[model samples]
Target: MKANPGSAAGSPTPVVEAKPCGNTGETVTERALRLRVRQQEILAELGVRALRGTPYPELLEYAVQCTAEGLEAEFCKVMEYVPAENRLLLRAGVGWEPHLVGTASVGADLASPAGFALRTGKPVISNHLENEERFRTPELLVEHGIRRAMNVILQGEGRPYGVLEVDSRSPGEFGEQDIAFLQGVANLLGMAIERQRIERDLRAMVEEREVLLREVNHRVKNSLQLVASMLSLQANATDKPDVRHELREAATRINAIGRAHQRLYRSNDVRVIDLAAYLVDLCADLNAAWPEGEVVARTPDEPVPIATDRAIPLALVVNELVTNATKYAYPGRQDGLVEVCLDQAPEESRVVLAVRDAGVGLPPGFAPHASTGLGMRIVTAFAQQLKAELRIRPLDVGTEFSLVISLQAPDRAG
Candidate 1:
């Protein structure tokens, strides 16, 4: 959750007043008790709201940066925890250019608050930046004309999640009270970040499940093809010619159905056909099976993405038409031509698949309702399945069949 709500210009005008508590004659123990009470009130309010109401995604970053900059500090920054790396990374900061805004990370160690917080699961404070001996690089603040800073650890689920830091260009900017208040803000930020990470992981899991289910469907399609092949072998070994012919046609159509899944199953694309690639392979197989005539295939340069429902029927329709072109369209002629072409239709919603043949035109009378041939029925069924318009026209030299169905990107639907 690298959600930096604070603008680059700096946090919005703070509503709270900023002041310094002059060091009086109070004992160190008394002063610490008062500062701890202030921290308690801030944390209690934060906890109440988080438990009672919905929180905005950017609220945590907003509060951290706003509170720090509101304290009239010279430089302020917040670092979010990266659990995978077991480190706190700088996410947002003021008084720095774009280069320094998302700078780097600080692993858990004595010098960095992120490191100390993870070790103790509590906030760490540096009362003075200029006179502190623990810091090896005091020039970091002197170079930027900033002298003081404070660090607060954000705890989520009892683990350190990040740190809230406030710095000033002057030598003595933050006191003990300021440190305590920022620590409360850091605690709120940690809880919000933890919640956001969980939601993100859940969303990724859901998408992964969808992909797995699609893979399972693809596998089922392959199994169906194996079943069809087994029946084909049984038919070939039988003596009855009539049974053999019916079984043979059934096997062919079933294989055509299987081919659709076979292609889709092998691809990572769950819904979309490399219709161009699919047609090329389908035509090659048909050519080998019925090589008496020449069948030429063509497709669009761009890819066409059709969902499962539309893709299955579209592939089978092409299968039946091409199979027929090989069988009957070139009657008594060994040297005819079958050409397949695919192109994006007008309106960009449909793709046109056209199969043309240089052979005798459609048989004398091929009425859909009266035709009993398996090939004609297959074409009609698939056309209806794809919600496509199937047109058969008599050309000057031969016949042409065109199937048009609207195309949609897989992202738009299943």
Candidate 2:
């Protein structure tokens, strides 16, 4: 086989000369000794980069390049292991035939320096590639004119990921110092690969958790719709006008609760709910529950968002106003109007909702707020829950009930 100018094959066609270390003071020996010190420096730099946020795969490349510079060989390669196939695949490498860099691989049990090191979990120092008995492709060595090589296995977290193999065109190219220095480089490489793997796994876990939360929200929406359906059926069974009216109003209120849950449950966020949509839907349901004859409700154009806790009582207030207008305001065949309005009062950091109905004005001695009626009690309770102040004024036609609620901004209609 052709040999490198400065290297010579000391033994036979394939001879692995990993015998023992001896003190040989030559210029090459001194250079190899100096390279050992650099290997330690590279390792220190790699550690600093890891702490300072260098990516994992790039770190692997850096380590592979350092090994190549240290050995000063004709060809240097680092191959990573794939446990499923029990073979080492090339990840980072240098100084090889263009076609061989990524296109070739050596079996773990094959006759190669890497193969030998993997089988025994030890390094293989071959001074003569042609005479190496354990080499899987001794003939390839002759074909590529590779006379000698030195290989070190990188043992990572679980198993040896790859081999760092240094090659030369001549024979007996590496000594004891080369093997020792190469081993240190392999050790640092192993640690970096394992660190990268752990980081990737943690990120994957966080993403998976977020996906599960969205799925949970979807399931909750379905459950709320079922409850609304049952309320609808119950309203159908009642016969008495008073009982039927009460049941229907109850069904409407229950449906509002269900719709609120539906809106909140559909969102990716469980905390804040889109107040505009929920309020529009809820107030519409309230108006439909009992006909106001000429009383129509309206909503704001821009959307507002609010926490679920504040929204619940806010929706119930809307229910009470619509119910009161239907039950008492337009008593006979008199056509009247019940206007519902919501305006964003960000300067005050609150949302104002007012219901105006045209009917017989409140009597001078009439105490609507002091009444024992169930509807009045409910309205007062909900207003208190929102930490809002309720203002009841006698309109020329009927009465106006206005409540101002503390909210984040961008008031939603109700």
TM-score of each candidate?
0.62, 0.59
For each candidate in the order shown, give its overall lDDT on alpha carbons.
0.65, 0.67
Worst 10 residues of 1 by lDDT: 7-16
Instruction: Report per-prediction Cα RMSD to one decimal.
Output: 10.4, 8.5
Give one digit per residue, the lDDT tens place, for model 1 in 1-414: 122232111211222223344577556456545655655665666666565534543465456446654455656777777878766666777665547556666665556544665565544445444555654333344567666556667666645656776767654334434554776577666776667667677878876875786687678777877888888898879999979866766666676667677776676666666777777776775675456766677877666666766766776777777777766777876667789888888857788899888777787886764679877788898787666788888999878899877875334455
Task: For model 1, state the Cα shift of residue 134 in Å.
Answer: 17
Task: Name the TM-score of candidate 1.
Answer: 0.62
Residue pairs in candidate 1 whose N, alpha carbon or C atoms collide under 3 angstroms: 74-168, 108-115, 109-115, 146-169
What is the lDDT for 199 in model 2?
78
**Best TM-score among the predictions, by candidate number:** 1
Candidate 2 ranges with C-alpha deviation above 4 Å: 1-34, 52-56, 96-103, 138-150, 164-185, 240-414
Candidate 1 deviant stretches above 4 angstroms: 1-160, 167-169, 173-203, 210-218, 221-225, 235-244, 332-336, 409-414
